[model samples]
Target: MYEQISHSLLNDILNRIKPDIYQKDLRHFYTRLGANFYAIHGLFAKLYGNREDFDLQAQRLVETMARQYIKREDELKQLDIERERDYNWFLNQKWVGMALYANGFADDLKDMQSHLSYFQELGVNMVHIMPIMECPEGQSDGGYAVSNFREIDNRVGSLEDLRSLSEEMRSRDMLLAMDVVLNHTSDEHEWAEKARTGDSTYLEYYYTFESRNIPDMFEQSMLEVFPETAPGNFTWDEKIQRWVMTVFNNYQWDLNYNNPAVFIEMLDVILYWANQGADILRLDAVAFLWKKLGSTCQNEHEAHLILQLLKDCCQVTAPGVLFIAEAIVAPSEVTKYFGEDAVIAKECEIAYNATFMALLWDAVATKNANLLNQGIKSLPNKLERATWLNYVRCHDDIGLGFDDKDIIQSGYEPQSHRRFLIDYLTGRFENSFARGLPFAENIKTGDSRISGSLASLVGLQYAIETGDVDAQENSVKLILLLHSMILSFGGIPLLYYGDEIGTLNDDTYLDDPDKMDDNRWVHRPNIDWGKAEKRHTPCTVEYDIFNGLKKMITIRKEINVFSDFNNRELVDVGNPNLFVFNRFNPQKFHDRVLVVTNFNDQPQKLDLEDVASWGTYKQGQLFDLHTRQKPEIFNNTLVIPSFSFYWLREM
Candidate 1:
């Protein structure tokens, strides 16, 4: 990693390092800096090399990393060493995550700590607390608009309370994941306030223009992220008499990575949170980091470089902290967030498998696996060191971002099929049991997204409304079936908060003026402890879902073959209603499990002769790992009951 020009610049930067930093732990700091300097220098140069103070900025970057390294606690440093020794530790199958809003789950961070045992009871070892950063009360995009990066929102808890929560989770051997909004900051942020006051230095930290000439040019290629709510990419700031890039909303201003100072500052913020015990930092809106005039201003090449630089910088200080790329793009572009490297994830260690998630929804609505199987086959293989964050649902609206070619291959017209899904899920179609709302419907393009909790979208809400016991039973089975796929889907299955007990869409958000416009808030229900208690009551919907998910998590943790080391093999069983795949431990050929899911409401059969190559399906007795019983077999075939799944292992 030592290059002549970059290392020469590194030596210059190191010599100018303050005596206090040099005397504290110079050996350790210097070694890490030296190793990562080449990539850092190259990336920084790519971003801000044309500047007059390029060398000075490089010096500042090194100083920023050094200060953070000096403040990093001994325990954290020890963790860094341990993780370095086992670089691929995160790819293990034992890690199951649950994403939740702290306040929604409990009263506050302190109350959340008290309920850590709740997560333990559900067999969840990783907790992703949605953004708790300070923001303007009404303008906060569910905590995405950050007014202060260092302070935890008082409504959630103080920094001390968060620290206590992290400590408690660590004690219970649970990983803590928090959000760091890397793309933009709230207009109420101190930097924005300074810019409003006409501070030139701070004004340069964001993308601002005095006229509409450049803004109009950029708009030609830029797609509106929230067309229904926040229409344009740039917002005119009345205070400054200028237009600023506001990709998400008017209250959120995009930072200028073209400025080296901004890059160095954000890097410092990342390391700061890592020191606060965030084992994983979900970098928000990473694909929008860099903007170009003639491009969509997303997934730009420079954006990838920025992530690579950020990862390299973090490695120098807090090597143990991993990054989850929150870029929910197409399947082709999603894997790039893990970086282009073959064996190493230079950008992020984990990414959201949005394609797989959307495809699963397709299977649910069509009652077939044709699209799911074909769509998954088209998904590009991820990097070796990286893994996926698979989920049935999350806190965001689900967009049908499948490839048109894959849809055609599955025998569906792209445009009409998407419309069918929207209609079916919104309950506009006759006999459709789903209770979902159409989110961000684009009138011009006829494109829309679906927003609702898994339980509601899968018919639990409708079943309860009609008081249909049979419908209720089928809904519960479908819920378990969807989870079965994600659990065995070769990644970390992320359970959304409240989904464990079949919590329904909370229409209460419709009553709030601020939340009424965003239907995604419907799924962000506040957990009712009173209702949650019913999870222990036999035959209740709560009991069926909670215990069912807990059972899956328990089984998933015990299977080494489930680890995501490129061991999944999709099987085409000729039955369009069934989706089948095999998971195996790469190190042991004999250790394998065949996962078969029936999307039909009637019994479906998979011929054992077609899967004889899977080793033992032809002759040996097979047991369902989920039920711990032999599957019903007849005439050289396995019968999967209505809306059911099986984890078949040869015994």
Candidate 2:
């Protein structure tokens, strides 16, 4: 850390620091820079040492950090110091999160400011507001295609509104999470526009070429992200008459991270949001940050370097802020987003547990946890400092990205099982109550993902539509069962916006031309405050879900064992329908809670004899934490009801 070369570079950067930056009141900025200059210099050099203007660019990077730090509020600076003192504070079980779209969750950012009380009522301490950055109207991929990084989208609210909302959220001890589209920019973005005008310097910001000679090679190894819609990875810009690497869509051009200027610009954008009161910045499309020909253009070695560089830079500017890697790749690759380290998360502090979500859906459809268990077994252990953002549902399609070997180990054909899930959720399978739709269906590969709200995909929609009270009750239990797993799964459990109240799929997306093309919009519904009001009535469907989730959240917060200390142990109950796991304090193992779930429609018995060492057992004593009653165990067997879960502790 005290390398002479790095210190020398730091000294050089400090000497070149703008006089205007130092002339202003920048006590906190100078302190942070002094504390982190060594790491910053080292990472910057590693990333751009070969460039002729590396020193000049380094000066600009330092200036960007100083400018953003000066703009940050004094109270926020104090909050940052408090968070730094408690580095692992976010890993606590009490930090429940809810991810929502600003326009959909409320009317806009202003409306969201008023909903702070609602979040507090639900025991949510962190809220991830989906991308609100300025984007082209029709070209925006659900706000992923960012046209401007600094400006707020007018449809949501102004930058002032965001600051106000963030202030409100902070006052209530709730954290705000926002997105920064790191990998790509809208075709209408300034850089893209300049590239179109044949600006050679701007063209270097993206992967643009006059010939398809290199793009064709990359296509051979790269799989289509949107095979049915976007087709290939490259898109032709008629105005520029050049091929641009557009992995997601033609309107979204992938940023060239190999260029040092692009890297510095994105880092500035990241720090800008942190200064704007974003506690966590979810870096979008991180896996595709670096692209190399003859490879899949994802999970590349240089991609990790880019993230490492970015993380190091942020450590100097805003160490209190955390990064969420939005790389929904394979389980092995997903873990790497936390970075290759022994005890530290060099790349991101948090990463989405997309594999766990997909695996949970598999268990629901099959009425068993065989595949879930097998798939989880294959999941690599993450870095000690990093935690997962586990959730049952989010504003995205559920892609069955399970490992093929895990499917074989679970005694199922990989292709057929995936097909069965798609059919079951889409209502193509017999006796299936789910009314979901297929998304990104590739006819050649017969691969597709499912898209539907938590309630609709879980059969509550069909149950309510048919007026089947029993079916509805069972669906509600199923929803609670899934929530229980994420709650006790040794990580931060993230609830989607409307999942707590059983919001059904909105077919109205079919009426919107811009949204109808994307089936994922079916699940991304606007919150109905009127329907949400029914949560207070005990007998209402809204009441059942809302109160059930609220109770679960309260219970989860009370259990310290549920924190991310890697203290979970999977129990082999021998029954396929019974998924059992235990969470205990590593220091005091007896301070534990046993989580047992039944995926069956009938009563499933767990043999108490097999779990004697796993819990407190003297041949007969039983406890169910959720219901606050002794579970009936006859002849050393405990009965679990249909679609139910028990958070059992010692009686």
Candidate 3:
């Protein structure tokens, strides 16, 4: 296990270790650092080897990892060892996640602790609390624009509250996920403030130029991220009298990864949060980390290299900690975040399955699975150690980022089909009941994204306003149908905060001027304790949605084939109204479940003969696991009810 070059460098690094730092028990620390140091050194050299200060920076890199390893608590160290022994634990099906804002889900972190029972009641074991980092008031991009990396925003709670919450969560067998904004920081950050005063060293931390000559070269290939809102990729910094790269907002400045010092500093911040008891660190805006002229500056190869280096350094310090990539790009590009290795994930252990989420919405609008099945076939295979985080809707606008080739393959024109989706979701199309709104519409390109809650986008809002009992029941069934896919889709299903109770599009953000321009806030609602209590009341909208999800979650926990190990096979059923797939235990193919979901409002029949070889027959019969009863079979044809699904098992 010894590399001559890496071992020689490690010996030199240990010789320069500070005398004042205490290293009481570092047996596991030295062991892991030795195992991972070879890759860590090679990646660092690839990134910064050309610089004159390469040797000095290499010493600092090893020193930083050692310091963080020393700061790690004993309990966390033990967890790291236990996790290393069982490397694929996060891919287990027993884990269910929910993402929410710190204050939106509860008043603050202290109050969040009291609501732990609510999550347990719904069988959710993984919790992702959105950004509570210090950010500029009124300019925070929902806490993405961090003014300080080490301090928690006082409005949410202090660092002590986060540590306490992590402790309580571990006691209850739940995982804690926190955000660490990697691509940029607020202009008010300490380094930004120092750079404004003409400090050369601090100015290297950000991308600042003396003229528009360079930015102009960058603009030719880089499209605007927020075209209708921010309009450009560079901002004029009057304080420094220079142009600075601001990919997302003017107040947020992109960090210069070309500078080796900035890379080392961000690596320190990542380990800082890992030491704070964050089990999973969600790296935001990871796709835009590396920028190059005459290119889109997204999904760049350098970005993947940076992620690989960051993950290797994390392994040296906290092996148990995992990373979730927040890269919402094309399907082919998104899978790159998991690294190029065939057997293991060298970059991130998990990534958002945005393609599946967008495809599911397309099926809901067309009332068929033609595009859904076709689009899913184009989904790239992930690494063996990596899994997808599947969800229905989240706290962001839905961008129709499908590839044009896939649209053509599915028998639809690319441009017109996207326009039709916008028209349908926004209720501009004839008889369309969806109440979603168009967000960030670009007049030049005639393109826009849809923004609305899960309930409003799927006819629950319209059904309630019209007081149609039949539509209400259909909406409830459709809601369960969507949840059933993510649950049985061979990945970890992440439920949003308000989705369980059918919370509608909240227009309350319109009253707050700071949030009025952003339509995405409509879905990020404050938890209504009073209304949430109706889950216990039968025949209520809240009761129907809540109990439906609870029952599905319980059943998913009991299914052994649902764990993500690349054990899913998409069925090409002739019926376009039904989306069918097969899930089986990798070790035992005979133990399998055939999933059939109907997206149409009309009843559809799936013949058993279509899946005769799919699984072993048990007395020539199939059982519905969700209903705990045998499926209705009349002459070898299973008649699925309108907007229904079945987790059928045989043998």
Candidate 4:
């Protein structure tokens, strides 16, 4: 940590530290900076070594970390020490999270603070309030396009209000997660505005070119992220008389990480949020951080280096804060966001389990686990210190990003199977109960994603519309079954805001001109307090789902075996209708729970002898953790009811 060359550079930087930073206690800062400066120096060099101002940039990076450390609250510093002592604190089973839009969930930050009791009632200890940063009204990209890095949107209340909400959450023993859009900024942002006015310094902040030659070359390999809407990766800036890389949309200008100034500025933004009491910061659009001409411009090595540098810098400033990688790439590439380290995560501590989420949807539509079983088997194992943020639904559309090999092994053509899923969820297929809409449909590849609330996509909307009691019951069972998988599937289970009360897809966005173009808004509904009240009324759809999920959350927190320690073992039970796995405390093999789910419309039986290798399934009295009832076992075969799951443990 204190290598000669690195420490010599550190000593020089420390002596030249600005008066404001040197005025602070800085003992802790010096120790941490010394420990991490070697890696930081190496990464910063790799990213900007060729620049004339490389040494100046390194000095600025160290100064930025010192400034943030000076601003970090005393209480937060104590929390950092505590978290360092228990490095695996976040991997515990007690941290269940819910992702929601601040304005949609309640009125704003203050109103959301008033409803903290609602979160506690549902047993949710962590809450990820989606992007609420300042942005242009109509061009906000659902709040991802930021106009200001330090201010909260006026619609979502002031920064003081957000601080109050975070403080309240912390007092109640809850964690607050916020989003930091790392990749780009709204065209109306001050930086972009300056570039528009021919400020040479600001012009270098973004990817701008005078001619179309380089843009054309890059377009040859760059895939259009919004082909239906934006069409290409480069947008011609009329005022600037040049082209700028706008990978997401025309109004969202991508930042040039090639500029060390950009990296330093973004690091300041991350630390500012951490000081505001964010326990977790969701890094948005991380995979597209760096771009090259000859490649697809995603998951590039430089992007990883940027993230590693960011993590190391944050560790010195706010070690209590964790990062959730928002990269929803291929199954193989998704784990890379957790970093290449075999036992520890050098980048992000958590990532979205997009493949597993898609696989669960496949089982729901097919009424079988053939693809779900195979796809999960293909998912690479993540690092021990890193975990997954597993969920059934989020603000985004459901993408079937399954590996082609797994699809072939499951006896389906990859292209046709993907088409089938789009058709099935969009209600274009026969006997389909789903009421989802197709989002981002690509005419060239016939590829698209599904958009709708969990309740609507899983048949609750249609069942309620037709007033079919049997269909309604089946939908409720399907909802609980999907949740059971995420809750016990070796990660932190994230519940989408409206899923607990069976909130249906909202068509209100259809009337708004700004929102009509994006069907993802269909699932991002405003909570109806009148309907949410039904959650307390017995036998209602809301009551069934809310209470059912509450029980699972309670059970999950009590089960130490559910903690993610790479202890999950996928069991091949030789039954296609049943998806089975085992969860056990790695230290105590005898303490285990066998999770079994029947993805069929009819009862499925699993022979206990087939899973005898799991030990507890061989010869013991077992009970369902949810129902607390003895499972029906006849002739050494266990029967799983249709559209249901069991978390079985020896009684």
lDDT of candidates 1 onward, in order: 0.92, 0.88, 0.90, 0.93
Query: How much does candidate 4 score in TM-score?
Result: 0.99
Question: TM-score for model 3?
Answer: 0.98
Would you estimate the TM-scores of all the predictions? 0.99, 0.97, 0.98, 0.99
Better of 1 and 2 by lDDT: 1
lDDT of 3 by residue, 428-452 (tens): 8887878899999989877999999
Name the runs in model 4 displaced over 4 angstroms: 615-620
Clash count in backbone of candidate 3: 0
> What lDDT score is found at residue 502 in candidate 3?
92
Q: What tens-digit string does per-residue lDDT give for candidate 4 at 472-507?
A: 999999999999999999999999999999999999
Q: For each predicted model, how many residue pairs clash, with residues at least 3 apart or on different chains?
A: 0, 0, 0, 0
Over 333-440, each residue of candidate 2 has an lDDT whose tens digit, in order, gives: 999999999988999999999999998999999999898888887899877788999999998899899999999999999999899999998989999999899999
Residue ranges of candidate 2 with Cα displaced over 4 Å: 24-35, 615-620
What is the Å distance of residue 248 in model 2 from its true position?
Answer: 0.2
Top lDDT hit:
4
* Cα lDDT, model 3, residue 378: 92
Candidate 1: tens digits of C-alpha lDDT, residues 535-575: 99998999999999999989999988889998899998899
Q: On a 0 to 100 scale, what is the lDDT of residue 42 in model 4?
A: 88
